[model samples]
Target: MDPRISKQRTALVLDQPFFGVLALRLKVVEDASCKTFWTDGESLGYNPAYLGGLNDLETRGVLAHEVLHVANGHCWRQGDRDPKLWNDACDYAINPIVLEAGMLLPKGVLVDTRFKGKSAEEIYGILAQEKRQKEKQQKQQGKGKQDGSKPDAQSWQQSASQPKQQPDSTPGGSSAPQSSNANGANTPSANPEPTATPDAAPSCGEVRQYTGDDKALKEADWKVAVLQAAKAAKMRGALPGALEAMATDAVEPVVDWRPILHRFAQESSPTDYSFAMPNRRYLHMGLYLPSLNEPAVGDAVFVRDSSGSVWDETQAQFAAEIIAVNAGVQPRRLIVMDCNTRVTQVQIFERGDAVELDLLPVRGGGGTSFVEPFERLEKEGIRPAFLVYLTDMDGPFPDEAPDYPVLWASTTPLKRARKAPFGEMVEVIC
Candidate 1:
């Protein structure tokens, strides 16, 4: 029996929480391209002879490591970063989490305590800084000429382009059953196993049996699979904290606007005494004195574009968000402004008042200028806790940012295509 298959079976037998069996479904491809073992966050690819040296636990650990790469959405998160450094960061992030699960990894796997609890994005920043420092030191030492040419950093695309192989040809060969005979019975044959045609593509359902690539997992199916896996691991009380965090992040993905709105409203709220509502405690004493209310959100301003690009329904949606934000903090006042090249209509509504858009006038149709709203606020002597601007972001921005936090809710399909000089951006997907 092949040691690779034997050890893999042994590893499965020793599964702490069934990670071995769960991860084994990834297409195991045998190729000499990888020196030891590597995954493109989709499939596990290795040189069979290299992995054959690992013990049963070590082999199982390696399998879990590859599966985790896909489970945690590492491939999808690698946007525009140096691939080698990204890979290193990802390894640093994952290796310790698996090792902590009482699994054994082969020696020389990257593991660093400093990167613990940090997301891959954070680790990538750290690695990028180190790479920059190394480059600077090399320049000071005159390692290269002042010419334009420089040694290239690691490329993610290069690694992503590696050819995938069938499980039968993987590092140690497949443990799957052999082909069925013409009589429809499984049988051993002296002939070589037939290989899939190079140009052949796997069907949708077949993708699960192949590499756990991002394309295969993108259709909201992975969420269901990952949630089930996480639930099983939790039941065994063997899920590592790091893996748990990643699983929670995948299962209940957070939207950008949620936290941004909460923080902005909370931080900008104010406190004051109100004569209208006396303290209930003091009311028992028959005193009609003013009561101190907990700090509530201060005045907040929201600006919208009344241009041809923005529709009434979009304006209504934006108004609803403002209403919600106001309700959350109970702001003293909520000001809504409509503008294009200049301020067209300005309406002020108290916390309990309804915003009637039909009653307010809509102005500006020639061109869009984001500077108009800020100027109008300053001219009207109206100060706000924070400002939120809703637009398609197709206008010229002010030369300088105002002295308040601004949240730009864009209706654009691509959020990254435009940027505000200051403040955060939230995409309106609806």
Candidate 2:
């Protein structure tokens, strides 16, 4: 069994109060393999990731969450994933549990910080900031009653210098939210900038995704070499040498695999059952940010600097590029990085469903270091044919963008930088 995934299929059935019940077969999987529904049976499938890690508490929590999904009939929800319906379901099912479990959350559940536009830490920071802002307003209002005028931003900031209070909850079936004093708890919430424009911490980046499984690429060097050579030629405005390199015997070898596959499968299928056909399709996963209305092909990379903050811009622009392979195109692949200019992770987005843009890590709101994207694009083996970014262009970037043809689109006004890189620049309302 793969280290990242081991599962036991359950035989349990469904009932009225619990949408379904399941039998247990224990399996072990890698930290990474938790992405899919590793456990499946007649009634429903469960994602072990929900359990985060397999401690007793997490195991129970995951089991409970899955039970909730079954009970709510989320498995049978007719339509696809959309923000509204999904959020509503989470409110009904997830919130109550989280509120009740406030302090003793399972260790692994929240570890993988990937959300729509903010990192786990960044999102938490947003919560902290809101709390402080509210407290400031309360004190300012109290002073205003003694004098005359009302509280303002400055008064609120002054009040923020003081200590703060905290809320508590108990974990039974559901913890009833206690009504606290409005003088401190409510305080009119500082009017909140009209329609409560969200103070987004931000989310960012799509890892470089290759089209084929790693093993397939290893067995198909010639095909992949040809593809890479073509891209190099286009990028450098020269083709003859690259073409010659592609035609070489070693790096571009084409070996038939009929015998090799028979050796591996051990028991061959009946000749009549063996049938196949082939065509060309491709996909590239880049920076997938909700801030943009388009697609992306930029890898999420960390940068080098004093602060060591991972940069994830939701709005970036790309021109002169687009889809050219399946997310699992055997020949292409995605790369990843962290904030300290070190690579933290690299996973291929082979399956269509694996390409998640709304996860917290990529869109986590933070100052993005810009030098990494170009360095990634210029790497020797990469063959991505297009690029796009959704960014506000608010921070530092590399001295030069990659020479490969590119497109630059910014979702927000060029806030702090001259402009982002690309051949074409289009301003978007989103």
Candidate 3:
């Protein structure tokens, strides 16, 4: 009834050195009658029946494999790949490393000699090529249907190692032919159109994830948790070189646009006073009024570079990014301005108000010039904390940089060749 509890006890009793700490970090849940063990970035789902036969070492090894899955972000990295193949490729890359680290995988666990030392990505490519070849052969024989698109690259590593183990669907709706060394867990087939999970935190390697079921694992920002756990493991001399090398990328992952925008808003030094926040000193004297000092909020200005290149889709995505970033900063007001040859339209909203561009009117579809927007701001005597210019950096610049900070968010391929005369540059990858 409590197989996960038993596994934890085993990890503590037989392998307290490393697994003890790792077990504590992972959220382990029990599924009494499942065919395999699995993890969904947030929690490790275990089937007691599948694990009952393994000894303590083997059990610990299985547990480690699941942890490695979450740590390595295999769950999130499956980007547009076949789930079965992605998992297999991940196992191929991780299993050998696990065995080398002294843990023991159960017998019959998939371990290919050819994929030795290759990354999941490299292996996935090989597997994908094999799948393509097989698909081509099947088509020639008139035994299969073509989807018009190429076989998924993510399937590359999975099928390369095991071309014959086609996933057979079980009556229970789960796919059969379990992912190689996916600890024999039963996984659902890949979605025809696999997209990243919305609101799913960037796989930060964190230990917290809310699975909704209180009995399940809690939610967290994985990026922070993974980095912290790795650091802690290293400090305790428990982190393996293999794991360290894998975690290095997550520790210093790409600079996210949200943080960049939030920081831009945060850098503002607001001096406005609000009667809502009365001075305590004056309140004691029976006088409640707006404080002369201590501003609780600031304004954010978004300058839209509405050139022909900035398509509708790109514009909407940029607006969403602005809303998300502004939500984090909790600014007092938001002003959206459109500029192509010049500032064409301006819409103002309060902090919590929704800025829906579709409902509002937008002006401008002319040649681009970065000079007009700043010039308009100066002419209008509007000094926002900072200005976020959403553009492709394809226009003439102002003679001098503005007094306030500016964030040049571009979507052009020639980013490096183009230059912003001043202000930080953030690539807006929509």
Candidate 4:
């Protein structure tokens, strides 16, 4: 280990343990061929000359930058995309975060404020869109010249008078010129520009593509490590406010709610084997086997929180999933109940009847109360196979868990969803 790198890692450990802890996970190796610094999700590679050019603060920043690329899973995220562009997008997404931590990155590194709070995927979309648009414009210009058509006077003058912008080297050690257009248009020059030399490029570092069979395992390990680092930082009162939600998400990962909803419905439905009705296919083969029969998924109750907290779009999405699940399970009846403090509207769909969202009544703008739906179910003498409640889980709960299984499809933070008195809780991402 280089003494300077070792000293800065220690400095990070004392000041920013979250970054410091993650930084230690990457084994540092000096590579003369490396332009500056880079990480392959597991190890950090750097050129000795790069570190020697930076002061202590900038060196520490470079280390944290690489650590974040690993911690944020950027290396494993570039799937089938142009590698250079993906690297640029990842740099845009994380550079602001590094700068916000009050660490100094060497000048000329990619840092676009436009992508400050966006994820790498989101930034990639914008960059990809810009690239496509620019390519289209260039293609049109080329066609015009081939057709012997002259460019408009203003357009020709603008092109001739505009000073050529030199390509700026990204932290990834590749030359990607920063867009000078105020609108953030990243247009490449039609003619190739000279690539920046290694010595002249910024020392902000690079994130290499993670190409290994254990990508999922590595990603899961990083998530757990992030949670642990966050805990350690929190204990020392050093956790950044910007990272609080990220840490919380690490603690309770956000997953697609559709599969979870489907699983809950499937598990809660009744199943039995009947010897009276032998399997016809097996009977033809002279093998007498008991027929496995799944009873019609009995009445499924869907309770919607209509207390003005949940968005209409979220309800529509939840309703669509419920209908899809119902189609799969073929429930005998689907009872849609819109409730707040009390059950406001009820729409029941009997077996063989079309279940349509347009027919379902939407009502209620009162306080939230989970007790009303249960009370209504009891009053109607309708014992459902399962009940799915879509809410923010910011309401009063029933005194006891009901006999029937309950699945809270909550549209709140996982911490709040965990407060549900009973049943399984899955975060409903809107």
What TM-score goes with each of the models? 0.46, 0.25, 0.41, 0.52
Candidate 1 stretches greater than 4 Å from native: 1-10, 143-219, 254-430
lDDT per residue (tens digit) for residues 1-430 in model 3: 3655566546643443344554556566776654567777666677677667767677777777777776665655565566566666677777777787778777656566656655565456545545554566677545323543334443566768764522221111112111222331223223211122212212211122233453212223565667776777677777788777666654444445666667667766465677877888788789988875546566678888654445444576677777776666666777788776666677777865654533243455545678877887788887777889887676788998888878888754322326788988886543
lDDT of each: 0.61, 0.31, 0.61, 0.75
Off by over 4 Å in 2: 1-331, 334-347, 351-360, 363-366, 377-380, 414-417
Most accurate candidate by TM-score: 4
Q: 253-372, model 1: which lDDT tens digit per residue?
A: 535564566677676665678887887887878888888767656678888776534444456556766767766777778788777566667777776666542334344443456897
The TM-score between candidate 2 and the true structure equals 0.25
**What ordering of candidates by TM-score runs from best to worst?**
4, 1, 3, 2
Best by lDDT: 4
Residue 43 in candidate 3 has what lDDT?
A: 64
Off by over 4 Å in 4: 150-203, 250-279, 282-430
lDDT of 2 by residue, 181-291 (tens): 232121212332312222221101001112234534432532343354445434555434322332232233323222322222122111221113211122134432232
- The residue-by-residue lDDT of candidate 4 on 107-150, one tens digit each, is 87776555555566655655665565568779988878876765
Arrange candidates by lDDT, descending.
Answer: 4, 1, 3, 2
Shift in Å, residue 267, candidate 3: 26
- The alpha-carbon deviation from the true structure for residue 266 of candidate 3, after best TM-score superposition, in angstroms, is 28
